[model samples]
Target: MTETLLPTATGGEARSAAWTALRRVRGHVALTLLVLTVGTVIGLVGPWLLGRIVDLVIDGRTDELLPVVLGLIGVAIGQAIGQTVGTAMVAHVGQTVIAGVREKAIRQVLRVSEGRIERAGSGDVMSRVSGDVETVNEAVSGVLPTLLDAALTIVLTAVTLAILDWRFALAGLAAVPFQVVATRWYLRNAVPVIRAERVAEGSRAQQLLDSINGANTVRALRLESDHLAKVTAASDKARQLSIRMAAVQRRFFGKLNYGEFVGLALILVVGFYLVRGDLVTIGAASAAALYFHRLFDQFNVVLGTFDTAQSATAAFARLIGVAEMATPDLRDGGETDSRSGRGTDGSVSLRDVRFSYGADQHTVIDGVDLDVQDGEHVAVVGTSGAGKTTLVKLVAGLLPPEQGQIVLGGHDLAAGASGSGHRCVLVSQEVHVFADTVLGNLRLSGEHTSETQARSALDAVGASGWLSTLPDGLDTVLGRGGHSLTPTQSQQLALARLVLADPPIAILDEATADAGSAGAKTLEAAAEKAIAGRTAFIVAHRLTQAARADRVILLEDGRIVESGTHDELVDANGSRYAQLWAAWSTHR
Candidate 1:
């Protein structure tokens, strides 16, 4: 399967993304532009006042010196105030934009099909969320505003120089051609290089995360050397890309320095001629030279910030791309029943089901049909690669089959009837416990659940025994840093939350597989209580769970080979369930 967290925007798409982001904060943008304009205008007053003061001093007008100096100070103060306010406003707008992008991106990720995320891998998606989002933030907050200030400064200074003397303005702009060539060359070459750098960095991060997550497995298999080698290679590649980027910057800066030299040389050389010809006063020439010098400083700022600007552009595009992945409203063409509470019956049915991870790969789930009655416990057993988990995911509405229809409580599962509607809840083996109070963790199951309700649910899942041992009972915090829970306790807590959620159908995919023998027993009892009066499907790794189910299904290569009650399957001489029972009994 092709693994991609989100689509990468092309040139046109990147522009559209940037425009969209700007439009979101148009009011702040307009205000910032006004403030910056005021600041830029105020900044011009100082240079002009300096020139006037120089002329006055040369003409021996001592009386005007104090007034000009006072005016210069006032202009400087005004410029400082305007710049501070402008920068703050820009930062506020940029942060607002970043927050909106993050919220939208999170929503999109939450709504995307689970199958897509599973195929894409967590590292890739996380990189986009954390790394790309941060990159965009830096671009908006720092690089963009700096570039804008530099641009405005350059424009106003050039215009002032022109008004003073057209010849001086022309001389000041002598470096334009060289600067343009160098900038264009740098941008064109740097884009692909930086893009490669980002890709390499993401790969390196993924490699490190993989090693960390699988550290125990690596140690057990004595594959530390192999994993370390992989990490080293990825890190080396990232280092090389970083060095290449630095080299690109070095070359670009070298060219920019040469341009600055040429421009400054031309300005001084031209200003000397104009002064010698008596076409311009010494003060005017001095002002023109200062303008030229200031202009080059602004140009340098622009050039220096260009790399970050480009990187931000790329990051913005990626962020926007992920945000755009939100699925279309599933209720668009569907009818909404006036139903309020979840229906009592939780019967589920799958018809002509078929699914595959990718178009090019073989179908993992072939055309199959099944019926699960209300409040019936069905345990599905299969060997590795038998599509057991995929089947349950389809029924639980976590995935959509390529070609099939799943109905729950007479409502189409795929037609926006399921999510958070108490229709179905799937508890997989890997359950996450938030860093929150025990009460808070339980409340996450039902947003409106009261403390009393939470306590009762915990009791129902047999977690009350442990709950009382905690320092603060239900109020006691549970995840990292608070109260740590064992694997069994964690699974029990998950079951408690399930009881609170009280979905009509509960799908448990080896939910107790991680618990020890004693913990597994406790979890089994808790699971039984949690699923009382609810249609339950257990993807059983241990045959004991299947033996207690109302019906046991045996699957082979995505096809249902045999299905019957525990007693009936055992009696069937050569059936798949009978063979499985025999093997399970021997293992036990």
Candidate 2:
């Protein structure tokens, strides 16, 4: 299998995403544009009033000066009010759209198959949720308002210059060629650098996740320095890329600065010529020059944010891609089957199942045939590298077999896990206690689960003994900052979730391994209750789990070496299971 990163939206798809978002907020967008346009119009009056005041002063019409000063004051106040309201509205709309996008992306990601997540590092997906969303949010909230204002102001200023004299507008056009060239050069150079920086940042994030997530292992193995060195190197590489991007950005700005200088100088030259040629009054020429200068400032705002806009665009594309990722609507379903000598649902059968991590890697699961009767508690026993967990995942539909058929509940595994009932579920020793109330976490099994149902699940999982000890009972918050659960307690909680989900088929891959020796039996009993009446596939890390199963299978090198009752396997002299049990018994 070839591993690849999650996709980014193509240009067309990004545009469609943007259009769809904008259309959803079309009402707010219209109001924002209207208010901003009003502000721009009011602002344009200021320079024209300054020109009128100059002309009046030159003509000795001193009385007209008061009105012009008052007009300037009014213009300032009106523009300020309009701009403030318009910008806030636009920002709110932007935030609303971004929040929806983030939520959708997160929801889709949570639905994505575990195998795909394993192929694409979790760090890459997490960074998009946090870092990329932040980037887009910053652009939308911070940069967008200013860019809109500048652009609107520039357009109105150009029109005002034209009203004063067509020549003034023509003169202002002098900067266009310079700005155009600068923009072209920047896009040609800076865009590639920005894209490279995003990739390098993603790599750095992945390395950071690796270092942090494996901190305990790194310390235990005494390779902390090695991991730290790799993290530092990745961070430094990203930093270097950022610096290179900044250099390109600065050079782009320098070229814009040249355009600004050239633009202002030409406007002045044109104003001076018009004044000398008697084509316009001194005040008109002065006002035209002032308008061009104001235009340049707004032009700078619009053009200078080019890189930030590009960054946001890139981030938005990634977010939209994630949000739009296809997900199967899976529901557990089963049909009647008597292949296992029992006319019951939830019987699982695997035929020549094979799997490998990568093309270059050895086959992790060789041809393995197995049949699990409905409600049968089957345990798979294996040494450390025996691919037992992989088999369990395959049975639970978490992974696809490379070249075999897996039928769950008489339904082909390739057929979507859709039925009228709860679907197959996989639970591992690594349990998750989300930061939520006890009832809230339980309801994760199904959002519609009632408080009564949650209580019942806890009771079913043998967690009722501890439930009464919580400060707020079912309302008590659990996980990170709230109530801390012991390993056994956590496993019990996980079992409660399993009961709430009530899948027809359950795969428990070392579900009790983390409880340690002291609580092993307690967790094992809870697991029994959780999977009662369901076809269960247990990846038995400890022999104790195997001892309780209806039947036990020994796996070696991805093949089933022996399949029989645990007692039968133990009775067979010199067999692998017998040898393992003999050693286990000696230790006991």
In terms of lDDT, the best-performing candidate is: 2
RMSD (Å) of each candidate, 1 decimal: 3.6, 3.7
| Candidate 2: regions farther than 4 A off | 1-3, 216-225, 276-279, 331-345, 415-422, 516-518, 572-574
Candidate 2 lands at a TM-score of 0.91
TM-score of 1: 0.86
Candidate 2 collision pairs: 332-423
Model 1 CA RMSD to the hidden true structure, in angstroms: 3.6
| Residue 510 CA displacement from its true place in model 2, Å | 1.7
Question: Which portions of model 1 miss their true places by more than 4 Å?
Answer: 1-5, 219-222, 269-280, 326-347, 352-364, 383-385, 397-423, 446-453, 500-502, 516-518, 541-548, 578-588
Residues forming the 10-long window of minimal summed lDDT in candidate 2:
335-344
| Backbone collisions counted per model | 0, 1
Q: Write the per-residue lDDT of candidate 2 for residues 103-184, one digit (tens) a residue.
A: 9999878777677777777877987899999999999888999999999998888888888888788878989998999989
- Residue-level lDDT tens digits of model 1 in 1-588: 124546666768777765788897888799899999899889888877887877888889879799889999999899899988888888788888788888888777876778887776666678788998889888877877778788899988988999988988888777999899999999888999888877777778778888999999999999999999999999999899888888999999999988889888988888789889998877888888788888999998999888888777777777777887646343322223233245576889989999988789888888879999989999999888998998998887778789989888777766663432357888899988999998889887767888889888889989989988999888888788888999988998899888877778899999999988888898888988989888999999778889999999887777787888999989998887888789888986
